[model samples]
Target chain A: MTSDRFDLGGGEPIITLRDIAKSYWRETLEIPVLQGIDLEIPAGAYIALMGPSGSGKTTLLNLIAGIDRPTGGSLEVCGHELNGLDDDQLASWRNLHVGFIFQNYNLVPVLNAFENVELPLLITGASRGERRDRVEQALALVNLEDKMKNYPRQLSGGQEQRVAIARAIVTDPDLLVADEPTGALDAKNAEEVLGLMERLNAEFGKTIVMVTHDPKAAHHAKHQIHLEKGVLDKAVEVNR
Target chain B: MRWLALIWKSLMRSKRRTLLIVGSLVLSVFTVAVLQSLLTTLNAVTNNPNSSNRLVVRHKSGLTQMLPRSYEAYLRQQPEIETVCALQWFGGYYQDPRNFFANFASDETTLFQIFREEFGASGISEAQIKEYLRDGAGCIVGESLARKNGWKVGDVVPLTGTIFPINPRLTIRLIFKSPKPSDENALHFHYKVLEEGVPYMKGLSGSFWVRAHRPEDIPRLIERVDRHYANSAYETLTETENAFNLAFVKMLGNIGAIIQGITAAVVVAILIVTGNTMATAIRERTTEIAVFRAMGFSAGRVLVLLLSEGVLLVGVGGFLGVLLVNLAAGGVRSSLGMAMPFFADFAILPDTILACLAGALAIGLLATFVPAYAATRRPITEGLKAVG
Candidate 1:
């Protein structure tokens, strides 16, 4: 544990983990999901987590996204320690500092692409004008400005994923967490979505943590961390 | 606002299911409306104080017992009793047994005076009334029955008696149109004619109708009349006409209770069916609800969406039912044929519609409790995992 205090002198690490572990109870048997993990990522860092199935890559991404709490660990994101926060506080914190992109492109089926992308701004107390401007800018970054009014079902797989990416950066959060962002797409669509993520990282300086097992998807990130058996194996820095 | 749009889209997703639920609500509310109208009309006819002015004096034992015809003269002697007439229920039928109508034999002289508002020939002169009174075998029939039987003035009408035991043939000298159409149709003739025609009914009258000096003094006058005949050979039981009419309705037992029970059952059944439909709707929209919650909608916002859908369905249904009931009021009154009065007054329409809306809102709240809680309680991680 890091004394339960933010090290503001070090300019606040975007994410900090110390001995993080998570377990599930299945019929009275303890199923350890993540065991004794320690890591840190600074602001404006694009990090990719790669691992085989059942290797806790998605679990780690969830912890970083503030959507799940670790059973035993000291975890901090955006200068807030998340160990003692209640569910509502965590939700509020996620709304303010985190944006997520799911592999399935979890856009609300009923709303148009612009509305889905603008959702994160609703909880931030932003004015309507500010929300509209930011949502439009984000959509234009993903080259989806023309398809803003189209629903998720009307868009192609590549377009839906691009809308999801636009949603992730619309809030201008300090951290973006995407789990298997390209897992459900064909090769052509996946490459298009990867190109959009790379553009978001380079053009906007967004600190992103993407979990994917595909090497081609990992190549879009500046750094990749592999996980094996609930432990971080190694890290590799990739060039554009 | 965003959440509301989402809910509207989700409700529109299955048009057939939504229509089915709404149709069921319409049917339930329609039935409730019609039943309430029937009860209201029956209550109005039986309890309207303005229409009931004829006091009924029967035997102290019961209506089955008869009073001597001589008591009619004795009753007329009292200054408070303005005019006296006797009526014996001649449970008679016309061409078909199902063509039921009220038949009574009364003194023609006072029949017109006592029931002046209910019975009067629209165009006939007083001389005709005097002539009809002079002729012992002359009769007066209601316009409805006259039209049904195709009997006009001066036409002979034949009626078979079930209680008096003889078929009576009389000439209708006058056709009385009801001054108030809401009043029951009655067939009236001379008591002397009936007595002369049937030898066993020589000195007997079933009940007496007395006109009081003041309507408010009816209760005191009834006590006075009963006291005067307290020890007579055939004791008299006197009551206001409204009370007398209500006694027949009361014979069916607590009608109000029966109606309340039936209405309650109908409401409960509707609630259950509607609740089931709403529960299924919420269950099927679990993923969408999660999407809303993740989009920064509060738990209360989701609840409002569900409740709004319910109100829309039930409120529209209730309004349609009210319109249908109002449209059918005249047909129901004519079909009931003197059994029920025309009940056009829907004073409780607003409250009934509100009750239906409240019932729907309650169903919405109850059905969505589990799903709303589940969605709000879900980890965003799990909710996002629901994709694909």
Candidate 2:
């Protein structure tokens, strides 16, 4: 394992963070969650964020995904400076550039797998045929094309997570931010999900940033960035 | 339109909750529709177009008061009057008191002449009129009344009078149909039956119905008749037939206001109920809403989706309510017509139906707006942490 300053050295970075700070105000009390974070993640690099609880790992991921606006400093993801964009503009930018995978699988219970995967495309003004093709391709890549009509309730934990992955990748976004992606799955299902993530990173050249506490989950990434008390340490390259 | 499936599925997410809210809306909308239609039906009585050329002459004191039978002769003497018929309320029932209906004793000689548009317009032959006048104990019934009582021509209808205390066994000489439903739910017999059966009522009448020669003659005839008997012992109150019907409606004392007030109250109740229900439903979907927001659904778009779900719910309920009222209108008309002559044509007007649906949509938008907007405004991260 080799540790270095937080930069993957080859192509232009897809995500650039500079002196990023985020704080939530609970009434009059300002609670700082992340402060003065600076990092650059090159395109096609699969990375994991590891930290103890309350270390702002998810908060940093939220900032990178453009779901949360930083209180100070600049965030540029996929070449768009996020700090200058308004909330709705940021949402539109996220729709085009970012995809999200949540820990609990977060599949809308009322929607079947196909509809869940098709959700992100609904806002893109994509033609019906285009959306259907993209959704099918995403599901086929996740190897769950046969379960397109099954609802989340009918799916196993592993299947639901795979469907979530399908949903995240359906739009073919530039960045994928996942928070605790395998937190709820059993060990076998977790291994399967991590293998799928490896395939997404290696075969599809997708830039993946996932937050997890498990060491084995972090090992699936090419590099692991650790955060403690809103500060980022050096990145460690995981040797095969 | 593309989001319709999502909205529909979300609304149907909790089938029991959605159904309960829809049931409440259906009941609320049904109540308002029926009450408004009843008010419209009552108003139609005073706006009847056929009554424009007719005048009613009643005792000056009130409707229940009696005028001298000689007033008919004076009414006929007016140059503007084309025909006159003296009528007395013979409030009667059939075999049972529960079968009560409006029955009147009227001058048979000029009955058809005064109501030619009502009785003759529907193709009643001259022979039928003559037969009714020729028989001493004969009556003319509206087609609906005859059908309701299973009576045909030459059938004997024994009406026991409540006010005059007399039983008149009269043959149905003519069964006439009128365009107005109210007119078709009444029975009219020869006034001579009461005149001879009860001697004291020989020279008294409840009212006189006068037909003017032309529509323009009604106003002048009304003025002239009231002026002629202004200070007499049996002073007369003359008005157009519409005003006469309106006077009866006015006797109910601000009934329209009462219905409107109740309707408004019901609408507010629906809003509160539906608002509370939508709030609960949205609260339960906090994580899902956050998931949608995280998936790049803008706040405004999500709000619209939730509102569409609410409106579709109430819209369906309102449509069913209006449909139910329309389906049951005939039975309601028949039952009310037997009890009150003014409600004989009870119907839910199209305008009322439109108004109900519009009101439902407005309520849907209103009831769901606050909760859905608040849900959208919530921090996506905070919402994502919410449990089911």
On lDDT, the candidate that comes out on top is 2
Which runs in model 2 stand beyond 4 Å of their true positions? Answer: A2-4, B214-224
With a 3 Å backbone cut-off (N, CA, C), the pairs that clash in candidate 2 are none
Model 2 local distance difference test score? 0.90
Worst 10 residues of 2 chain B by lDDT: B113-122
List TM-scores for all candidates, in order: 0.76, 0.96
Q: What would the per-residue lDDT of candidate 1 be over residues A50-126, giving only the tens digit for each residue?
A: 88999899999888877778999899999999987776676677777777777888776767999888877776788
**lDDT, candidate 1, B1-388, per-residue tens:** 2545655666766788877876777777767766665565457656765535568889999878888888887778877767888888887777777677777888787887787666543666788788788777778887767776888878877888888778788788777776545443567888887788788789988898988777776777788889998888889999887777777767768776777788778778877877777777766766666555544455555666666766665666656666665676656655665443223222334555566556545655565565555656666556666664
Docking class of 1: acceptable
Worst 10 residues of 1 chain B by lDDT: B339-348
List all candidate RMSDs to the true structure: 5.8, 2.0
